[model samples]
Target: IQQKEHPKFKRKGDDLFVEHTLSITEALCGFQFILTHLDNRQLLVKSQPGEVVKPDSFKAINDEGMPMYQRPIMRGKLYIHFTVDFPDSLSLDQSKALEAVLPPKMTAQISEMELD
Candidate 1:
């Protein structure tokens, strides 16, 4: 049966895509949340400690999306497209705190620096 829309997610073929926004803190420190699926299932979506989810990146939950058309046993993947919501500016205290908690910035090789 065709429906007008699924409020929480959008479907592409058999896969489902969720557009989610995370605070800079959540992106860096990792987060956990529950998602209500189209079929009335609660899904746990999370990130491991120290796992940074970059902006515009995606993580997929296998077999958690839509079922294939005419294929009941098989299911598509749920893709969470993350957008990191960074502040326009950070206070000195916030900056210092982040520096202490986060890893050092990655240094580029001499060859790669030329591309910057």
Candidate 2:
């Protein structure tokens, strides 16, 4: 896991800005598996961290038939899982535009396990 600190700003008074520092942490989880054949005892092995997000989290269903509550996880971030993976060569402007459409913290935390 890696943590980075960034300065945050808020408007105060007529033309003043207040600043504070915030931290962000990133972690990588890995998994490995092996398949073995009984006849020759041959083994096939694979290892991966998997994709950042799962697809089903973005699926939409009729509210009438769906359960009263639903939870989803995306990009290792809970509740804020609605994201589209563009090609590796996407431009910086394109990426920023997509990020602008993300849900706010409260909506994103709708499925969070932590109380606070």
Candidate 3:
């Protein structure tokens, strides 16, 4: 039997994928939330402290996906892909505060520029 749609997750084979969006601060500082699984189970999807999830990064929760066809107790993996939403710009005060908490920016070196 084949099903058409699901409210929270998209599936492939037995594996499930969910696209999660996080703010820049959340991505950088780490994120945590409860996800409603395919079987109506609430699962914790979290990142380690100080573990920054960069834009378009992926995390996985094993044995949390759909159950196998014949083996009702066996399940696949749940994959979470993160999309970091960064603001276009920050105010001077905000920038300063962020700078203080973050590592120093890496500077690029260049000698000269030629315009056409």
Top TM-score model: 3
Query: Where does the lowest 10-residue lDDT sum fall in candidate 3?
Result: 107-116
- Model 3 lDDT per residue over 1-116, tens place: 76878766899988899999999988988788988876677888888988999888889888887889899899998899899999999999999998998799999776567332
Question: What is the Cα root-mean-square deviation between model 2 and the actual structure?
Answer: 23.3
User: Please, what is the whole-model Cα lDDT of each candidate in the order they appear?
Assistant: 0.89, 0.29, 0.86
Stretches off by above 4 angstroms in model 2 are 1-28, 38-40, 49-116
In candidate 2, list every pair of residues with a backbone clash: none
- Per model, how many backbone clashes are there? 0, 0, 0
lDDT of 2 at 96: 81
Q: Tell me how candidate 2 scores on lDDT.
A: 0.29
Count of clashes in candidate 1? 0
Q: For candidate 2, which ten residues in a row score worst on lDDT? A: 19-28
Worst 10 residues of 1 by lDDT: 1-10
Question: Which tens-of-lDDT digit does each residue in 26-89 have in candidate 1?
Answer: 9978899888888778888999877989999999999987889899799999999999998999
Cα error of candidate 3 at position 59, Å:
0.8
* Order by lDDT, highest first: 1, 3, 2
